[model samples]
Target: MNKRLLKLAVTSALTVAFAVPAFANPFSDVPAKHWAYDAVNKLAQAGVVTGYEDGTFKGDKTVSRYEMASIVAAAMQKDLNSDQKETVDQLSKEFATELNSMGIKVEAIDKKVDNMVKISGDARVRYGASDSYDNTDFRARVSFDGKINDNLKFNARLTSDNMNYDDEFATKTGIKLDTANVSFDALGLTNTVGRQDLVLGNGFLHDSAMTGIASEIGNLKLFAGHLKDSNEVYGAEYGMKLGAADITADYVKYDTATNDVDVYGANVGIKLTNSVTALGEFYNVDQGNTDANAAAYGLKFNKLGLTALYRDVEDGANSAYSGMHNDIQTLKDEDGYKGLEVRYDRALAKNTTLNLKYQDFEKQDGTEIDGGARTQAAINVKF
Candidate 1:
């Protein structure tokens, strides 16, 4: 057979064998009523053939042996039944020279296209009862990661505000863009700019969202940003490994209208044994009128999947205007609360977990807030 007729015959056979669902015709030249239209469109959708840069399927044009080999290589990557596999094997054998010259080029292109973008997300359903309220709520977040180039990347996440099923499930709709950032490497530093989450020194000092720029070199990171409430924040953190322990130091300055607040702290984690780890953090806040400190020490039993922490936060110790660790529920209502929190986590299934937590907290000045106790259970899932 002639080259063009041969190409048409091979494509027609493959199209009938593969039998993929029809897609919207992508090439203007291949009209619905044309004899080769269905075959061409199916082959294109299967990645067995790509017509031209201008998106035209020139069926009358002859295809070279190398081009036909590329088509066979692509068909080899598809999921095929026995008969289809035998036909592809025969074609591959006929074009062995071209396929061998191509080497890993086809595989590289396939991987690049597959890894160009990724989507991931997680959701949580939580039930909690405290002295003040008992409720059930749900929260979810979806994230997208895109590669701009070898050295640059883009990421964004959409988050839903906690929807309380106990109260306004039907009327509450609170979905928003929570994080959007682009990161790249330049000037011997890794840089990120945009709205992103910031967590400093075990979250004893700050764990919130900020919009600005951050740069990291080795174990050190520097950032300058503003909070949702318009409070300007600048911080630095350096982490190092000493002996068998990991230590991190943090410094953050918050620029408020009335005064500038400084929060500095250090966190250390040591593996006491193969199954036990010790964690501690100490933070000192220097506000214009209020100067206080916060400290937390915890023990994690890795084998048991349990963690216990004790927190003693003085009033005004947390300089961040928003965001706090949920381990101590009282921190949401009263800042100067001292508490002991214990949590146990168990794997329910792949990418799913069951978590139970209990906290007992009282005001630092010996007063009770939110009944001074809380219990919570949550099921977390990721996909």
Candidate 2:
């Protein structure tokens, strides 16, 4: 009924919300039963955070990158500073685009690491289940990207997760490149290359291909290679944009110990006005000279200042996998991965939002003919 009571109520529910790759932690400051604490109290009072039914803030606990983005954003929301706003906007774009290319959705917090070369990192100390000892991990990065020439620009980023977790840890410590970009204008057309994301066909192959080069000729966008086995698949993905609609195609091949395979596909997407968008695709695989087909479609709506999207793929039966087309398998039609998926995103604030996703794949009988169901919800924020 009252403001204090309202904060108390949601704080209880926020405890159960899944933060991803992060276990539900009761913030250290609030403890399990204490009512008032600095960190939790501020977030709770501002509607930025809450606690569990048990009533704990769990602040001292280690948080995942995705969750941290949300927390940082909540803290800076309602910020009206002009210069700060511009910087945050840039960080949000960069982060979101990076995570999106990985098929993971996150509210980009551009405000945290704007234009100025960023020097930031974190440390995580974990106490495994039923373990008396704590395992600690520390990682850091120093990134710089700015214009070197009037037309040429470059970027450099170095990061390390954990030496202890690496097994290669302590043994090796250095700056590992996480992301870098360069662009050039030669003669007439523009060419861009480096470790980055290529958005085509509404991202059906979103970040499907990692290392690549984007060369545009007139209306065509050509993407090629960086796909192999353990590292990545090296090949080419190409695209052509036409008025509100863009068509892209790619050929990726893999030769594993078990089998030699080829994946080829094409996608077409249309941006219908400012509020609606759609995508369609066709993909095929060639193994042992046998071909299998897969179809995909996606939709996006951004009207009234809200974004909603739906994507579904009807992948044809392969030699045998429930979700795949494994022609190399002994039992034909026994191994392939296929499924129906749906995802929903709603913006709760200018920075914080909610996401809900569901996935169901083709299965057989009692056990899960192949794949069953996947459901998850997340609250994302960006500073």
Candidate 3:
């Protein structure tokens, strides 16, 4: 046989044998006694070649350069001998443009493609109701992320919200710049600057972005930023991974005239079983003469995407510590309040999710005074 014919037969057999399904030999046209049968069978076992849907491999037919390039692409990841590698390299070069267009890595242009930037965003619609009132809202966000080089990266996000859509003209709408940050790694530490998402200790206490600098040191993270009208603020957070359990702790402080105080919190999450997890968290903050504390315990069902939690507040649940100020009373009428919450989330489709949540606590400012219970449902879509 001519060299081209022989090469085509060997390459086709290799691809067919390595890539095809395991139920049986895919090609009825290729017989067991054929010279290339052993090669084709071996390739099939390696899952390198998948024959035509009709279960046929025309062994005597020649393959085009594109077909050979595709076959060589599959074999590129295989443990090939020096001669086989040489043959694959030659074939790949002959079809470099086609291979690249098909998203196969042609090493020559891989670095060029790596320099591209990416953008992504999400939109959400939410409806919430209680015995006192009902409301609906819409939110949209867009983000851009880019790598400046091996050592630096940039990220930014813009968010818009429309609140309480009683009527088109009565609805409240606003736009905000959510995040604009740059991150880099240097001097044995990872650092980020500008406005970035910040969370501490299971996010039971704090989960909002601030304008500041954040640095990572081993298992500890330190951040300092100014938020709202507050003076300089700083915090240190640490986390430890222990087998099936993760423990996290944080200490944050806000600098103000008479309200200067420290907030400390800790949380632990344990994997109870393959599909069940248990979590507990505690937070405390002392503002001037009053000290407040919040604690919560919850169990999460991973398989069902459900969580049931109970949270309690003592002494003071005022805005001095809790970020959910609108949900808590300004002054305690009696001790504090306790609430039970159940949340469920699931994927409705690709890049879309449904969230349902309900909670009932003491009558705060937002919920009805008759009985402080609230139910909310939201759908989020990403692009």
Candidate 4:
């Protein structure tokens, strides 16, 4: 027997062994009479292989081991008869090394896709009114925190703020990037660089976002940044745990257009009882010419989730502590307003909370300010 004829016989016999029922023809190159036609047709019908888009099978061309591994992977998902399964098993053994490597590659791709990206979001709705005026607002924020590696992390927050009716009954919406920063640990300090939100000295002195670099050491933090569109600022904060009390203090200097101003503040919270806590804070902003000072004290009853707050603005005028219903125009010259605030917080669900607040405002003369009563209610949802 001729060697060529023997090889041809063996190849033909193997093709017949691998053949399946004739299916619809998809490839013009592999005709009904082709030796591997049945096998190719069955694999195509089962979605195991798709030949060239030009409608040709190119059956004579050789396939790389990697390509054959992909075909085997697809075929593994298909239902197979015993003969087909046996043929596939033999091919699997022949290409075992390539298939194993392919499996590892596929698992690696899946791991990268699953572990590298994460997302979370929160929403809030609020309604409040001050004596004769009323307003409502809604907010939503979404955060993305990606772990780039073991040492570095990237973070960003997209916020939608105060989409509501203005004084004229027209709707307005504001969207902004509330936070964008990268954080890392180096030189015995945790460092963050970029635009960020800062809460200093129990939020009595500063609770706003700015752009800068912040570093923390133990219970001390230092920051240098542009301060809320007013001036560039440099600040430091230190916190201490003292028995049943937590104490924090901060000092900041602002370079304003006219001159430099210095700000200093301290906040202390003492747990008097398991369910009762006392809080106190004082803040002072000093210009070269004058000073503005304020103090706030409060008690929090955790058992009932109620908080009572009192604020005394000493200057009554020209105060940097303007958050608690102080008019900058009157705060600069005329007396400022003193106020007592009460808040109640309750959990409504596993990831939802409700808050209610009432505020009473008065003048230094102990007289009630007209339309000085303010009330607010809000709901927060998270997960």
Count of steric clashes across candidates, in order: 0, 35, 11, 2
The global C-alpha lDDT for each of the candidates, from Candidate 1 onward, is: 0.71, 0.47, 0.66, 0.66
**How many backbone clashes are present in model 2?**
35
- Candidate order (TM-score): 1, 3, 4, 2
Candidate 3 achieves a global lDDT of 0.66
The alpha-carbon deviation from the true structure for residue 292 of candidate 4, after best TM-score superposition, in angstroms, is: 2.3
**Best of the candidates, lDDT:** 1
Question: For model 4, what is the C-alpha lDDT against the true structure?
Answer: 0.66
TM-scores of the models, in the given order? 0.69, 0.48, 0.66, 0.65
Q: Return the lDDT, model 2, position 170.
A: 61
Instruction: Give stretches of model 2 more than 4 Å off.
Output: 1-144, 158-176, 187-189, 198-200, 206-212, 228-244, 251-262, 270-276, 304-334, 364-371
lDDT of 2 by residue, 1-383 (tens): 25434433443354244233234333334343333234444444323343343333554544444443454343345432243345444444544654444343343543343444434333222111111212223445456665556677676666664444325676677657756678777767577777755444444433432455667666555655453224334456666667767777776565556666676778876867534567677667676756666666666553322233332323332412112211111113334434555666544543445555455544332234322454434444432
User: What is the model-wide C-alpha lDDT for candidate 2?
Assistant: 0.47
Q: What is the TM-score (0 to 1) of candidate 2?
A: 0.48
Better of 2 and 3 by TM-score: 3
In TM-score terms, which candidate is top?
1
lDDT of 4 by residue, 97-212 (tens): 77767552233343456447556778876666665546555678998887777779888999885554333323445567889999999999999999888878666577677789
- For model 4, give the 10-residue run with minimal summed lDDT: 18-27
